[model samples]
Structures are given as structure tokens and as C-alpha cells.
Target: MVIEFDAELWLWEARRDDSWTFVSLPVEESEEIREMAGGQRHGFGSVRVRVTVGSSTWTTSIFPDSTRNCYVLPIKRAVRRAEDLEAGDVASMTVELVDI
Candidate 1:
């Protein structure tokens, strides 16, 4: 399944000293994915996915965020740099389920 959306890139406040950037999937879409993934969920209820932002594409996992009741896709520094993204910036993203 392929999902596309635009969301703000935010830093994980829990890790203030670390640079962990992420974009959250929409709540509705997250629910769909949760139902679809079913028993396929891996550690931390993560789902393998191939993500694309601007011209950068990479494989990663989206983890379930209980606070937000959704899945958050981590944006690696390399991809962020390649796509010219920063925390608080809105990014257009494409995510395709890899393992489910």
C-alpha cells in the first residue's frame, strides 16, 4: 500500500540532545495501516516502509506513537539534508508498505 501526505517534520522532544526528526502519518491512515498490518507488526509495533521525500528515497520503519495514536516516520539526517528539510518544516511524503 502506498500513502501520501504532507506533514510537519518535528523533533522528538524526549531526546532533546539527539536530532531525531519525524513526520507523523495522518490518524485515519494510521488506523488503516494498523488494521492492515495486523500480526505483521514487528518490534515496537513498527512497520517496514519505503519512503520518499522530494528526491530522496529510503527504506525505514514507522513506529506507533501512543501519544498521537498514529505512526511516525523517522527522517534520517542524510535524507533531510538531501531533501533540504528541517524540524518544523512541512514536507510532502510518500510511504509504501514493504513488509505488509
Candidate 2:
């Protein structure tokens, strides 16, 4: 299934403590995805997906965040540079939920 939405690209603070960057998925969108992905997920409640931001598209997995009640998309430094994205930047993303 494919889910598309726009959200601000924000860094996960605790993750950054370990030097990782993440983009948050809106709560509503995450809910929809959960329904669609029903009973299918990987380690850490992660759902595999192909994500696109700006002109960059890559395959990755989004992990559910209990604190935020949503899913967080990991954005590597390479992706950030290719998309010219930074923390707090609004990004339009398309998520193709794979292995669902």
C-alpha cells in the first residue's frame, strides 16, 4: 500500500544522542499505516517502506514510536544532503509500505 503525506522533518533527540537523524510521521498517517500493515512488521515494530522526499527516494523502514504515538522515518546524512533537508524543514513524503 502507498501512503502519502507532508510533515516537517525533525530530528529525534534521543536518537541524536547516539548520532542518528529521523523524520516523524504524522499521527493520523501512522494510524492508517498500522491498519494497512496489520500483523506485518519487522523488529522494533518497524514497517519497511520506500520513502521519497523532494527529489530523493530510498528504501528504509519506519519504526513505531510509543512516546509520539507515531512512526519515525530514519533519514541518513546522505538522504538529507540529496534532498537538501534539515531539521524543522517541511517535507512532502510518499511512503510505499513494503512487505505488508
Q: Per-residue alpha-carbon lDDT of model 1 for 2-28, expressed as tens digits? A: 999999999998887337999999999
lDDT at 36 for candidate 2? 77
Residue 75's C-alpha lDDT in candidate 1? 95
The whole-model lDDT of each prediction reads: 0.93, 0.83
Best by TM-score: 1
- Candidate 2, 1-100: lDDT as tens digits: 7777877766667665424777778888899888877888889889999988888888999999998999999887888888887877887888888787
- Let me know the TM-score candidate 1 reaches against the reference structure: 0.96
What would you estimate as the lDDT of candidate 1?
0.93
Q: What are the models' TM-scores? A: 0.96, 0.86
Worst 10 residues of 2 by lDDT: 10-19
**Per-prediction RMSD in angstroms?**
0.9, 1.9
